[model samples]
Target: MAGFDDITKKAQSFLQDGKVQDALKSEKAEDVSDKVFDGVADAVKKVTGGKYDDKIDKARDEADKRIGNE
Candidate 1:
């Protein structure tokens, strides 16, 4: 599942970067967090041809939790 791991890592990076940008733009943290999670989920779904919906949803949930904690 190296490919999946790579995709997850990349998604996380994208979320983190978006968070930073959002913060700079004075966006609410909660809103930014949601946007990041949704964006990642959509990207994962597109990349996997919609074959890994459960995994993507789980990843997005976990990422949201992690981002919220930060």
Candidate 2:
């Protein structure tokens, strides 16, 4: 299981480096939040074998909402 701190750090790096925009572009901006969320979710799922699927999904939804609001 990946630690929450590690996940957060990775996300912070993405934001700090402006990689989030790249990701959003790659995802065609369908839903910036969903794309970003799914990218992280998929990575976590791959590493943990779906152990955090639900949490990731909810996180993604929240992220999507936040992005939409921004």
Give the clashing pairs for model 1: none
Winner by TM-score: 1
Instruction: Estimate TM-scores for all models.
Output: 0.54, 0.47
Candidate lDDT values, in order: 0.77, 0.71
Question: Residue-wise lDDT of candidate 1 within 1-70, one digit each (tens)?
Answer: 9999999998888767965656644536657888878998998899999999998899888777654434
Candidate 1 ranges with C-alpha deviation above 4 Å? 1-27
Clash count for each candidate, listed in order shown: 0, 0
**lDDT tens digits, residue span 25-53, model 2:** 45456565565677888998899898988
